[model samples]
Target chain A: GDKVKQSPSALSLQEGTNSALRCNFSIAATTVQWFLQNPRGSLINLFYLVPGTKENGRLKSAFDSKESYSTLHIRDAQLEDSGTYFCAAEEGQGGRALIFGTGTTVSVSP
Target chain B: NAGVIQTPRHKVTGKGQEATLWCEPISGHSAVFWYRQTIVQGLEFLTYFRNQAPIDDSGMPKERFSAQMPNQSHSTLKIQSTQPQDSAVYLCASSLQGEDEQYFGPGTRLTVL
Candidate 1:
């Protein structure tokens, strides 16, 4: 079984629409980080959370350690948002390497 | 801050050859990590260093894979007698300490044929 699992392996969105990606963790994750891998293959950090929610511009993320899940919400999706979204979780505590989910491929079309 | 930097964005090598990938962490970060991504495996953690000291490498293959952080500024992952299966995008990341937001490099794409 995967330690971190992401839902809807792939997604297709229309411009100006909204979508949400989810991650379920089998491990007792202490922290969660969301990243967007652009077409150029560079990972852009979107959010880092610990059992809380954060909003940045058109993006918002929430992590629930107790429930062992995390969510990333994209509002007003744009073509630039087309990429693979990955969520990684850190188990236990300090210095632990992150365990990444398979990732959700997103394509926003106009 | 220049963020994490990885050299040789793309490399092609014949099987049985050697490949050395370099990573320079953020100026003040103390923890560095290495990961590999492949179409079949998605993403896998290879190793990690804290304060320039090897902390965990459980994910690294014992045989041909080796990593070192000789100083705070840089680290290197060397693969000996590389095989076709070794082809993947090697990513380097850095964090403030052991548990913080990690910033990743552009990644080094290694192809062994």
Candidate 2:
């Protein structure tokens, strides 16, 4: 039983298309952070949310703490977007610690 | 800033040996975190420190694993009696505060034989 669960263990999309990744938390999450692990295995920060929505360029993210879930949407996906997406949640008064999801491996093909 | 710096990008050790990994957080950052990544486990949290003091290490194995932040700038993770199952990439991250967005290092790949 994972504290944080990610949907669609794998995803494949065509370049210029769109796709969404999701995370569901069993813990009382106060904040959520999303990361993209590139092919070279570097984890890049994507978004950090506190029960709201944030948009950065072609990427949009939403976090609903009450519902214990978060979503990351990629618009006009590009080849550089091909990587593993991970979501981490900070639990109730968890202090700086985070519980991580298994991650979604996304492949964008041109 | 240099993001977070991890030393010994890769390490190989025999079973029952010891391994020590180091991390240097961004200047002035107050928090540091350690995580391990593998195909099966994905990214797993191991420990965290705030202002050079350990805040949480609930994710760490009860035996043979330890972490320490001697100062605000750096931290170290040590494992004794390393096993092959310990082979994975270890990542270090830093944030200005406990709840802020974290910046990660490239990670150190460990192979235990």
- Encode model 1's per-residue lDDT on A1-110: one tens digit a residue: 99999988999999999999999999999999999999889999999998999999999999999999999999999998999999999999866999999999999999
Give the Cα error of residue B80 in candidate 2, in Å: 1.2
Scanning candidate 2 chain A in windows of ten residues, the lowest lDDT window is: A90-99
Fnat, model 2, is 0.76
Model 1, C-alpha of A8: deviation from truth (Å):
1.0
C-alpha DockQ of every model: 0.90, 0.70
Clashes (N, CA, C under 3 Å) per candidate: 0, 0
Q: Whose TM-score is greatest here?
A: 1
Clashing pairs in 2: none
After superposition, candidate 2 runs with Cα above 4 Å error:
none
Q: Which stretches of candidate 1 lie over 4 Å from their true place?
A: none
